[model samples]
Target chain A: MNDGARLAAADRSARVRHADRAARFVADAGQTDWHDAVLWRIRGKRDAAAGRVEGWERLRALASEIKEHTLSRLDEYLAAFEEAATANGAQVHWAADADAHNRIVRDVLRARGVRRVVKSKSMLTEECGLNPYLEARGFEVVDTDLGERIVQLREEPPSHLVAPAIHVRKEEIAALFHEKLGTPADADDPRLLAAAMREDLRARFLAADAAITGVNFAVASTGALVLVTNEGNADLGAHLAPAHIACMGIEKLIPKPEHLGVFLRLLARSATGQPLSVYTSYFCRPPPGRELHIVLVDNGRSRRLAQPDFRAALKCIRCGACLNTCPVYRRSGGHSYGATPSGPIGAILAPGMDMKRYASLPFASSLCGSCSDVCPVKIDIHAQLHRWRQVAAREGYVAWPKRWGMRVAGWIVRSPRRYRLAGRLARAWLRHAPRRLRYGSWNAWGRARELPRVPDRSFGEWYAAERGKK
Target chain B: MKVGLFAPCYIDQFYPQAAVATLELLERLGCDVAYPRGQTCCGQPMANAGCAPAAEAAHRHVAACFEGFDYVVGPSGSCVLHLREHVEGAPDARYYELCQFLVEVLQVERLDAAFACRVGLHASCHGLRGLRLARASERQEPPFDYVAYLLDMVDGVERVPLDRPDECCGFGGMFAIEEEAVSVRMGADRLADHLRQRVEVITGTDMSCLMHLEGLIRRRNLPLRVLHVAEILNGSGEARNG
Candidate 1:
């Protein structure tokens, strides 16, 4: 296969083995606890900030409704966006899939004789493997976001959406910078490390020929692209370069410019607990003497939009609130997901992209519904996870052991007579079996938890006796 | 009210005291309670494992068992929610998790019950989010917990403050075995939260969660004990004879 296809296959394989990667991450108890604490703090901040809003739930409802309306008539909005963008002096490109998206990005860069590009944090590019695609085709691509830059320097994919290099410690970042950027060997301060990155990236930004950014919301009516970031990297990159490329999924459309108010009110508060991002840049028209291109990608999104049970997932605004609020993501770390958008949202979205590859993603959640609760668009995340599990099981993606085990369990619980017999046998075994036999390797539940004490009489038996007395 | 006491599978087999408490508690509240002999499981285990077809018979069995009762009440919120969501032909509105039934249906303002101990309330997920018995901690709504409200009316009962209120205990039916490592870690973390409060007892609406937490507590030989909300609300505190 081609280089891009080969890389995509390798990435899928890596994600398919999420269980092993997650186990290794969780093995480091101290790091896992630190990660959990950090993410939980973000969740707490989100809660406190969201609580202060007078009509937060109403805003979420309105946002959900707007997304639903837009998605139902996506073709119309896409046309309107393209028309308005063209009218506003911008070119529009539609990519059917990730490969096509990569090829389009390359063609755009090549036509402009661009050799260097600076990117502001765009998960769309990550999903499309645009960086590697461009790099293999002989173009220098620099990720300008602080967290993205850290991970890019390390030649690793981002671990979190809001904080891409959240898994890396300050000391590790210091070491990476020391090795790559010629910083002092013992430099461990955040300010110093950030300063070193800023100095190095400032040079790249000035010399870059093209700037690419991910669109947070693509307003169809005004033909404007909303880009939210704490760092002013998108502004610097998009303006300083001769060509600007803004990439967005087809589901990122809102019908009118006014609809942005509801989303803007919820996005930053849900993401990082800020009332608004430090920089909420709107790119309606390209800068003077610069070319503007909008690449609207529909890589497995149209298929997802047609699924009635899963259509709500498209309403995601990339707030990353669900990740912060997710217990599994906090403990296991983002890399455990082995996908671009890791955590609860990824679990739902990834399986739709490739079911056999991401079958384990849905099972990663405890289904506590915290992700759904904190979702600004009111996506029923946990319910969707449940639906995906059922789909996976039906499609025979579930392993043989689990499949037979659940089938056997289903049989036992269906009939009262067999149910009583199984309970009796289980209790008898627990009562008489030695500790070693009970807690052996074969028993997964017994590894960390003790067996419940077997009562001498079942509640059924006790209730029967109570009836006799009555 | 004629109440059908729907004992979930785990409570029927492993946690009989919780069921006994539910029975006696409902009786004390002046209801004629019936223990339907044909009732076995709520079909949640199968359905949650993504084998809903396997749970079909159990759903039919449960719906048939509780058909004639004026109201079907269960000690576990998780099972009640499963019935409401998954069971076809089942009376969704007639079925209630214990605390919800007492507070909403019975309009129980006070109970002649007493439990003299500081207990940490473990809010199980299905009850909190699915059943809406309590406002989830993640939401912006005004705080309300039917379980805690009922516990407050019982004399000599004090609730200890938890570090993270309303976190899942991680006993997600088949999830306890399917994803053992993460499940145990979550439960252990929850236990530590309660232990820090120096609680003598931890009580919740779901016994499945309690059983998992109790297993960890028992294995470590911790001083804490697990009790269903029914046992605390029942107030007898008498040890069951095996």
Candidate 2:
């Protein structure tokens, strides 16, 4: 996602959205312990179904190591995939950023003499603002997956990467289906809602000039793109359309299908409690005479590949597993992120584009580690967040007042004599601390906490005086 | 053995009783305990909150204070963890959480102290994940070590199961106040989980996290009391259980 765009949007929301409402909007969301409660329920079910699998952690390590190893040789893999893709009668193109990426996708569709496109869920496309770009280019695009279809009719982009409609209540979905897809107007049943969506998308699947799909994983061994979905829209989109375009980020490559097993195990279990997704489709050949195009979009991922502390972020499979278990994400609804791919993953990914602009995004996380706990490949989310904060500070993204305050903090803590003097003074200050601070930015501290009244003397002073008296 | 007491700044002033309890616990556990006069706060608040460069001078000062002690112990897990795990390129790194020092270094099988109550376990993010005191890994089967194991050893202790069990209580030093809405919500969520399990007293290694929860618990009028895990391991006195 564009940090400039997200920050601009977040800033605009800040004007109209009060801090109390913003906080309440997030708090009154789904539930308090929802992420934790839901994740455990999902995990407990998976553990039981999968039986006792040994080497779970090693598998994650190997997956992370393999991705790390692959990122180091990413250029070689990209070149290899390009060669193999071209040999297989598919075309490959590289786009440096979101605008460049959108242009490439639009050009491909325009050159094909196509004005209508169908799509499967792809966060890469969302990051590049592809749908709007294509629509602006005068092409009509329809989303095929059920969740995407619900969000598409609302004329809003997805709130989630995977489960795009997670924020909408079921009743809201029932009403949406009633108005958009012409389900029985009086009906509130999800089955009826699904049936209505199925009928509406079926015709678009057949008639669209080309189909766009996001790649979950692209295997280097077979030079194929992997799309894991429950709806099988990727298969329909890739198969039925005369032409298929797959938009994928650069970090999606692994050595072989054999390596797919380790990731496959962790992905579904972490994502939605399933042992494996309903469909794991691998497309290597143009399906029975249809043309295939795979656009390898960077949009800042190449820069992400070079950073030691952050390169691991490229390993994301878009499983939404991290979001599913993030306590912070559970509270703050995705719209608060004001960009695609909102959640713990989005908070970190937003800054990769511009450290100065999206500095607040990293601070959004509580460093709870739930995202890390549920992550399939073990992204040390909070650690990466801590790393980004340091990066942002070093790069001059931190404001001066905070920086000066931290400097004062560092100075006092670093010296026993100075700290002691400060402590003595602070004690006196605390004894007289008013309901509101007469100075400084932290009136919030006084608003909630009752400042402990200072004792008559410092503990050290008491210890020394008592010893002398004795 | 010479055990250096590293009293974190906040605990030294606001909660000296915690330091006193720790010192007495150490002496009772049979160590030649000494509070290093020049000791100061570990620079974690600066480091984790994105000012490691500013934290450098403090890091050096901490290294100097406990440089020669065989075991440096602190009442707060989060602070002691900063010494063992956070400080980078510092000359002095040997340190332990009071429980870890007691269980790992001293190997005290019995305490002259005791406590009786239904206590919930609050795992501080630093002590739990950073210090590897809790079983935290994605590669192997995870384990809960020092805190859980220590709590299990205490007399009359009933460890309540929290929903996420390991969810952070969200007293993230400066974060609790900086991002009060989300931070307090997270702490409140953690507290409610412990409450659901009907725990009357909650205990953890990090006092600041407990302080945050204690504030909320007190404000909300919940009967739950917050305890530092060290205070509990020192065990309850006659009539203090109430």
Per-residue lDDT for B236 in model 2?
A: 40
Best by lDDT: 1
Q: What is the per-residue lDDT of model 1 for residues A1-470, given as tens digits with 9 covering 90 to 100?
A: 45545665577675465556666787788898899899999999999999999989888999899999999999999999999999999999999999999999999999999999999999999999898889878999999999999988877778898999999998999999999999999999999999999999999999999999999999999899999999999999999999999999999999998999999999999999999999999999976788999999999999988899999999999999999988778878888887889999999999998888898888887788989989999999999989898998999988888788878988887788998999899889989988899899998888878889899889998988877567
lDDT of 2 at A80: 84
User: Which residue ranges in model 2 land beyond 4 Å of their true spot?
Assistant: A1-24, A27-51, A434-442, A446-459, A462-470, B90-93, B136-142, B236-240
**Candidate 1 chain B, which ten residues in sequence have the lowest lDDT sum?**
B233-242
For model 2 the local lDDT of residue A12 reads: 38
DockQ of predictions, in order shown: 0.70, 0.50
Lowest-sum lDDT 10-residue window in model 1 chain A: A1-10
B160: Cα error in model 1, Å: 0.9
Candidate 2 lDDT over residue span A70-111, tens digit each? 888999888888887787778888888889888888888988
Interface RMSD (Å) of model 2? 2.9
Instruction: Please give the distance, in angstroms, between residue B210's alpha carbon in candidate 2 and its true position after superposition.
Output: 0.4
